[model samples]
Target chain A: MDLVNQILNSFILFKAAFLILNLILIVFLLVVLQQVFAMSSVITDAFDSGIIRTVAIALLVISVSLFLTALVIL
Target chain B: MPDLFIAPLNKQEEPKQSDDLLMSKSSLPLTELPSNLHLFSSFVANPRGIHFQNQDSDEKVLLFIKRDLITNIVWVGISILFIFIPIIIAVASPFMGNFLNFLPGRHIFFYLLLYYLFVGTYVFVNFFTWYFNIALVTNKRIIDVDFSSLVYKNVAATKLSLVQDVSYDQVGIVRSIFDYGDILVQTAGTLDNFHFEAAPSPENAVHIIQDLIGKEARNGLS
Candidate 1:
């Protein structure tokens, strides 16, 4: 019985580690996506006066918020 | 011949090569030609100018092929770093002993497998980025297409005629060593500057644009 419990616990720990790693990867991917979107907007607004930077910052903020929410859920 | 057929032939012949007939009628000296004639005469007299204009207009629009060397280097570095993770796992495998026995090869195979997977993904992403971000130039316009990430792309272009000035700045020692820097193109009608960062041989690019502009100006004047 003790050996069974130990094996189950190890499995749980392994599952948790994988979950956490997946969460990290998701966050990294989201951050990268946010930057990419920002860069796209910047390129689109290459001729705009000052809206490009503002839009990029707003996107970054939104991505961070989304990442935090995902982290919390995870 | 029938009157209708004869009349049609006379009408066709009336306008045939009238310029020659007009020149024969005009007894004015060749030196006192009209302004339009003077322009044609100047063009004819300077075949070099015409050739230059032709070559200028034929100037090839060049687009910078995205090498993505920086991205590639970063990916390689990340892959190398990830290799260390497996090393750590291997080193700890002995300490962990039977606890990690279920990991198959005590994490050696797992680490190696994960490392390869990560490296493969990184290389794929880098290659895709390189394959997409391209610059396009034509006689009339210059375009910059930036594929910064997998899901996003940025494309911008400016008319060749609207480009007022082009400047290249390679400030840092690293940039100079790497032969890459920013190219700023100033447009006549736009307040914003089009900046191409990390472009190779930025000075040469600027010179190419300047030469094109110069040729266009000459053509316009002519």
Candidate 2:
């Protein structure tokens, strides 16, 4: 029974690590998105600004989705 | 108007500046440029797609440059290595046996997915840094835009009239082979000088800037 409890505790740690990593990534990506928006506003490249912003937004969305999935399914 | 004032014969005549375009500006366009120029090129002339903050309506961007693409090879290579790590681990998993025994086997796939997503973020951030860190030579001013990271974004500018001298140097075998170097502009007064680092074709950049400063000085705009 003690061995089983130890194994279960390790599994909890593994899951917790994934959740914490994903949460940190989500925050970092939010900052990135904001930076993209602010920088694009400062120097607008008619051809590439929109595309860069879209890419940033896409990354943020993917990150949030992954975080939610990890919370529910990890 | 010719100077009516006579110079003393005892005093030596001051030598005038020899106007020379050290590097040929023949290829640089003052007006229209080829429409096919790629947006990602490290050097671009007459960039129609570029517009910056506080730019005058009449201002025309004469030149645009960024650090050479070769400079990004390190990050590109690392990102590629990161992309393949999950595959390598999955293939080696059987040999390691019980390495991930604490966690359910199927859940490992989700973790791998999360890892790749984080790697994607790394790539995105690096790309953004490269894309935005650039310098521009407009008809009226010089702008150096430096976007290093989320916490640091620097945009430095000085009027063409304030530019006193322009020079570029290509050192090191790599810089020579890649044909990109630093272009330094000395400005007068209290304004800070501009340094365009890893600017592609620094020679031509210097020539273009010299021409602008010369024109501005001739018109007594400074």
Candidate 3:
């Protein structure tokens, strides 16, 4: 029973690490995507300011939600 | 109708022969001529003859004629694949689900229609954005016309004589077959390098620029 408990603890720690890593990756990707969208707006002449702002907000929300969910699950 | 017209028409025979010789020497197909093709200041042809500025003017830098390949294919390809792929999959899902049940949406046709709407809007926005943002190359200088976002734009140019080297790289089977690739122009300034990615007939572009450079250099020396 003690051995099983130790194994379970290790698995929990692994899951926590994985979750943190995933959250970090998600945050990084979100930042990069934000920059890309900004550059896209600069290069392309027809970027609707309203649409860009909305899409950016949506992306930010999605990233934050993903990070929070991962933290909660971990 | 007028004597002035008749006199000019009679004198036009010499020009026709000369034009034919020039066309043959240039090896350019007659059919592919730009609509506004006209000889501009003993240098490049300004097909439409819209003199935004004279060749002697400092504003000559703004007269760039970029190869059509850059704006037409590279930008178009990115816009299509990036904006259309998801919509295509979403629309086709109903038909796809008939063969397999593990699809995402419940009402496939509805999702498909919504996807089409989104994609159509996306493409429409991208098309005009790309169209106005390009600058073509002229004989004297490179033009950079950028309509950044909806409001702001920066159009600039650099001299072709300042261009030191021109190289092309076509990688992968798709690039080779499609004849679209990168054209790298090394210049004699602080600008790192001008790179046109996935431009068609890269070799021809390079040759044309090189020939222009050579001709300009000879003219300068003379």
State the lDDT at A5 in candidate 1. 93
| lDDT (tens digit, per residue) of candidate 3 on B1-222 | 655644444544322222211233443432233334321111123333333322444332212233333335565676678666766765796888654243234233333433444444344344434533444456576555455344465655567778788788988887787666777778887865667655556665566566556655765775
* Predictions: Cα RMSD each: 18.1, 6.2, 13.2
**TM-score for every candidate vs. truth?**
0.53, 0.86, 0.43
Per-residue C-alpha lDDT of model 1 across residues B1-222, encoded as one tens digit per residue: 555544344444323321112222223221232222111121110012111111245543333323325535677787678667767776887888746566545333433443454454455456445544555444556666667556667667777777788887888887778666777888886445577766665655566566556555655675
**Strongest candidate by lDDT:** 2
Better of 1 and 3 by TM-score: 1
lDDT of 2 by residue, B29-103 (tens): 433333233546788777667788999998878788888888888999999999998788778878999476556
lDDT for model 3, please.
0.50
Tens-place lDDT digits, model 3, residues A1-74: 99888867865665565456546545644554454355444333122434544555554465565446545644
In model 2 chain B, the worst 10-residue window by lDDT is B16-25
Error of 1 at B208 (Å): 1.1
Question: Model 1, stretches more than 4 Å misplaced?
Answer: A12-74, B1-61, B65-72, B91-99, B106-112
Which residue runs does candidate 3 get wrong by more than 4 Å?
A1-74, B1-117, B146-154
Tell me what fraction of the real C-alpha contacts between chains A and B each candidate also makes. Answer: 0.00, 0.81, 0.00
On the 0 to 100 scale, the lDDT of residue A60 in model 2 is: 83
Global lDDT of each candidate: 0.50, 0.81, 0.50
Each model's interface RMSD (Å)? 15.8, 1.4, 12.4
Please give, for residues A14-58, the per-residue lDDT of candidate 2 as tens digits: 889888888898899889988998898888888788888998898
